[model samples]
Target: MPDLQLLCLSNPLLDIQAVGNEELLQKYGLKANAAILAEEQHMGLYDDLIQNYHAEVIAGGGSNIARGAQYMLPPNSVFFIGCISNDKYGRLLKKSCEKAGVRTEFRIDENVPTGRCGVVITGHNRSLCTSLAAANEYKVEHLKDPDVWKLVQDTKIYYVEGYHLTVCVPAVLALAEEAVTTDKVFIFNFSAPFIPQVYGSPLAIVLEYADYIIGNETEAMAWAESQSQSTKSIAEIARLLIRLPKKNKKRYRIVIITQGEAPTISAVAKSGGEIEITEHPVRKVPSDLIKDTNGAGDAWAGGFCAGLVQGKTLYECIDMGHWLAQLGIQELGAAYPYPRRTFQPSKD
Candidate 1:
């Protein structure tokens, strides 16, 4: 593959999604619009989804963002790295990436089976229950491979989802340090609230090296609480995140927080202890048009990174994020609509 502009590190999972009711979610003790790792009790949920409901299997997790971005970017510009078992689901994952035009470097784990996520959709909300089997086997040594490290060096942007922290904090920290040293853009996503609440120490270490931090309001608040800023509002937390001590001082940190149906809030760090904050209202989609809300955040991040790759302004990047998010919500899974729509960056 040629030198890639965007590189992503995440826990890849084959997602089995189905339209379920509130009772189903309650039976599994899952809250709507939340992401959680599946425990022993939830092991049967996947089979239940497949047999009891109308299930749709799709590529999910970091792959969702990678595919979304690859759909907008030039061919071979995006590369993804993750661990997976050489099993049927893993084969499906590789094939899906190939179909989407995203190059991948997957570390094979013989001992563990491929990971899977059960997405139970209730109305427009989705509750995720993930089983991180092979994904949890990713090691720093995999990234140390000459071939993989070279891709890291060639990339302009490095993105990692928070869920990877539980599996390999060392890998994430190493990439963060590399981003600072190479003066590359490092984007971090707070994929779920448990990441900051449960994995605070490692998350803090990696966060200082992040040039961009993206998350929803619930995640932002959890992060604030982890940092002992529990009373801060979302905008204040965004500013605080930007002001966190950073390893890369060449560029100021940027924080973006998305609130469902509310304005997206952003804060950019500036010189002399200043912070620039702005809110971009979301484009309204008719309630009846929403098919699923599973990958809205990933879609937004994908669009934002695609904008960055195209050298668009920050505002334009946010606009692209919103545009992709709107389109993604209309689909049944974490997927964008087919026959891609061309997006023009706003001049105003």
Candidate 2:
């Protein structure tokens, strides 16, 4: 087996999740099933919910869950880069991820509170109100720390979360360029609609170095618009991404666009001018069984990357993505409720 190490740069968060009804959503001006950044003032509201409503505190953030896919990914193979306050929540976040076998590379910010989110879930409805706080404090300087730089130099694959674009686009671009010069695989995700919709130019430059890309329907649509293309057809969007000019001639280009409860669209470009774009159906979650969807896409990205680390075929890789996503929607927070159960490659 190939020795695998993935370095992820993401916003680290500690999540407090609870079950609440539409009444609470209306009271707080929260849109059901949507995630929006919140101000520090909102932390008190989340605290109230947790204190009075029995919310569970779990490790949260794109980087946290990407590493949390310890069930699918190799143990201790993921190194996460992010910032958190040197406080109790920070310790909780680190311990939670470590318990799942993910090695954390955190930049402790003493001046700010740890990043956190309040996830409110109702019947088939969920909403997130996040306080970026210390998470947003991570800057290019942190990446330059000798210890962090060493990991950057030693990594084989770079797994990036698009949210980092808003936090530090220059840092992300620099990492992409490094991946190109060093011949390391660069995997990028269109994390949310806001990223591609708002920061097009920088993201485009970063994608030039990406060997693999992952996006959901909304993100894909947003990215299509960012490229000045029509978003009416998802197939066209997939092809556009797959055909994106690559900086590394030896790297294979791959793109996947996922739709909740529907077939996944993918495009792959082989070295000899062979290109195939097709749809792969996902295993459906019965409507009654979905607990929360907060981390499904992140889980998919992690699982798919895990397959790549182990040299699995394209089809098998996507299957792992879907399977992990399905598992995610059945749980509450970013990291699943338990770490004992893990992914088993399909015999098929």
* TM-score (C-alpha, index-matched) for candidate 2: 0.91
C-alpha lDDT (0 to 100) for residue 155 of candidate 1: 91
Q: In model 1, what lDDT does residue 83 have?
A: 93
Candidate 1 at residue 226, lDDT?
84
RMSD of 1: 2.6
Candidate 2 on 1-348: residue-level lDDT in tens?
223377888889888888888777877788888878885446575767777779888778866545645566667877788889999889988887777777788888899988888888886777889888889888788888888888788877888888998788877877888888899888898888988888887788888888988899899998888878876688888778888888988888888888877788988887677778888888778878787676888878878887877678888888888878877788776555464566655544
Give candidate 1 regions above 4 Å deviation.
19-36, 39-54, 121-127, 345-348
**Taking the tens digit of each residue's C-alpha lDDT, what string does model 1 give over 53-75?**
97877778789999888878888
- Candidate 2 differs from the real structure by a C-alpha RMSD in angstroms, to one decimal, of 2.5
The list of candidate 2 runs beyond 4 A from truth reads 1-4, 21-34, 337-339, 342-348
Return the lDDT, model 1, position 222. 92
What lDDT would each prediction earn against the true structure? 0.88, 0.80
**Positional deviation of residue 4's Cα in model 1 after best superposition, in angstroms:** 0.6
State the displacement of the C-alpha of residue 154, model 1, in Å, after optimal TM-score superposition. Answer: 1.3
